[model samples]
Target: MDGGNNGGRINVAIDGPAGAGKSTVARRVAEQLGYIYIDTGAMYRAVALAANRAGVLPSDADRLAELVKTVDITLEPGADGQIVRLGGENITTDIRSREVTLKVSEIASHEAVRLRLVEMQRKLAEAKGVVMDGRDIGTHVLPGAEVKVFLVASVQVRALRRYQELSEGELVPLEQLEQEIADRDRSDESREFSPLVRAKDAEVLDSTELTIDQVVAHILDLCRTKTAEAK
Candidate 1:
């Protein structure tokens, strides 16, 4: 694993829009590389969860800022994937709920949340053996990362993937899910701070027709190439 990477390892940054399978792909890639997986979106989702439970509106920046400071959000590896903890509670499943998903963008749009979480994310990547996935990671969080992959898929494709992940009781119409994902894409891209633009040097991967294993394999190949170049 230490083959040609600088300082014995490399940082892999993955950025993408909603429901693009970024979290799954990044987690798998991190597992294969023996790297820590940092789900930056989950951090925001944790904030959204905290906000939701606290009755704090996303528009209330000062309140949100105070709320973030008082909460503790952490990501740790689990048997299945990354586990998220908020205030010492296992919120891995909670953060992925549709409510948190819908509010995450709004919470993340606040400069207070982004500034604080981005600092934490940057600190996590400083160790060099981390795979981070989020909208602004490659563009802002880790611009000099050794490897950057921007994953993308059609909105319908992404929405279907998300739909399959949700349990039956939480099901929404596929058409509605598609529209939600599309709206999120526009919101993410048009956000004033750290919008979801692919980094200039990042490799763009369209995984609309690719399996999870196929996408992981392709990213591993890129990791090898970048690590070799780092030598």
Candidate 2:
């Protein structure tokens, strides 16, 4: 992360588990604050997708690390949402597919891959005014962010929210999805390379019974307070 604050811009880091509405909330919060929204999870998914296509297995850490460097993944603002491009090819939707989802955690576990992506992430936040959301945003990516939040929800709530986001045909059984999310939580927390963790200074917000707008509003109020304090 940038070591110096340039001005009034606030770097908001939202970290949490999968299916906890981090991306949606982060985007809304950033839009409301007029800050740049970076979904680092999508960046990992992009690497996963590229590796899957190149006949590379997730265990091939060295190769996967090299592949991601050449892929040149980039995130661009889009009318519908954030557009993720790989090697300059628009693959926003592709990266979100189930295949990539299964590979992302494993791919992200590699130290080299994480280091390379972290460099890119830091560069994006150099000018501040950024709201970056992902598993380790607060703990690892931007530890010094002005505002840090670890958003979470109950397993059932998370599964249902994720279920609602998927199309009818692509939907997985709720029970199975919940189990998978639980398993993912385990993997994320157990991983050796900057495992998913909440920063000591980060405030936790449980969204098990909260609405998206409510979550965004809560974060916004926190951001405004932090911004004022910094000023």
Candidate 3:
């Protein structure tokens, strides 16, 4: 078993590939623990959104860094959940648009962008009581976190789930969603700095056949156990 029982407050780091229910599980775990849930992925998505607005191509590293510096990124919670504000303007809905998704992987693959965002993520997690979720949280963002959970699921399952969500509003076919999921995994895994990988000490949880509540409960149990030990 993972050792080190102390009174230090716990920080949960959840990492995984695309469509792996990382966001949902992390949010619930944070809510149950009364901790702030910071979505590091949203920061990259915001950068992508800003790049699109500035007309900076993905390869334009200098322009991308400049654009990131000019923006003030903040996380605010609402009744629904967290909202991402860039430059004091809430672009929460715009950041999750299809266009942002298309460009996010490219921007995220940039070393400059990831480094800048990683610093921000670290600052946000400086306080112990936080549950941060992202592709690299377990490995790079919060290596010293008390509990590191790497959530994974089969590509087919993830693709189908994403397709179902998209289909609720738009008419996206299964094949298209599968292709997008595959492409995103490729980008996330192949990125140079802090590519997605489970930390050696991370607890691997495969959600391939589990319901959302089941996964949330699984993570919550771990969180509670860790918190009890740390007390």
Candidate 4:
């Protein structure tokens, strides 16, 4: 997009914990604004998926870093949403599987892995007009982004959101899902490299009591305001 006459496109950075609706809200906001939506988390998950397939454990940081260098992960805007490709193989669905979910944080926590993917993310946003979302997008991936948002929600609410999205066959117990989400939060917050954190300039948004549409609308409003100010 041409930034609506400002002569420069705005880069939007969105960071949040799992199940805070970062992916969905960022996608819709980008669609409405005619900007590219980059799901940074999926990049890490693609790595995790590859590592899992190769029997590379998360504890093997050196091996995982090597694995990341060997694989080519690409994201393209698809008809439905962003399509994630690893080593030229479409793995949009595989990365979202429960197995990947349990291991992505470990893979993402490695300093080398984060360094490699962060470079890719920066390159993708160099031209601007991109809405990138992930645990550390605002803090590390696109620190100079024009607009930054930190989305949050209560643990209970977050778990429910995830359960609803991933539920199909036999339901996973709500309590179990809650614990899993909680565990992920702990790991994300305590990780040595690029641990989940709110950017100092980011606008904190609590979605605990808000719907997906509500959250997206709020972010769109913020983007509009920021872009208008720039003009």
TM-score of each: 0.96, 0.96, 0.93, 0.95
User: What Cα-based lDDT does every candidate model obtain?
Assistant: 0.90, 0.91, 0.86, 0.90
Relative to the true structure, candidate 1 has a C-alpha RMSD (angstroms) of 2.0
For model 4, the local distance difference test gives 0.90
Predicted candidate 2 versus true structure: per-residue lDDT over 81-189, tens digit per residue: 8999988999998987888887789999999899999999999998999999999888888988999999999998998887888876696898988998998999999
Tell me how far the alpha carbon of residue 104 in candidate 3 is from the true structure, in angstroms, after superposition.
Answer: 0.4
113-160, model 1: which lDDT tens digit per residue? 899899889988876889999998888999988889999999999989
TM-score of 1: 0.96
Q: Which has the higher lDDT value, candidate number 1 or candidate number 4?
A: 4
Per-model tally of clashing residue pairs: 0, 0, 0, 0
* Residue 231 local lDDT, model 2: 68
Summarize candidate 3's per-residue lDDT along 1-231 as a digit string, tens digits: 233442355889999988898888888888887888998888888899889998999889889988877767999887888899988899888887888888898888888888888998998877677899999998998998889999999989998987766735667778887899898998888888889999998999999999989988988888888877765
Please give the range of 10 consecutive residues that has the lowest summed lDDT in model 1: 1-10
Better of 1 and 2 by lDDT: 2
Residue 103 of candidate 3: its Cα lDDT? 85
- Candidate 2 differs from the real structure by a C-alpha RMSD in angstroms, to one decimal, of 1.9
Error of 1 at 95 (Å): 1.0
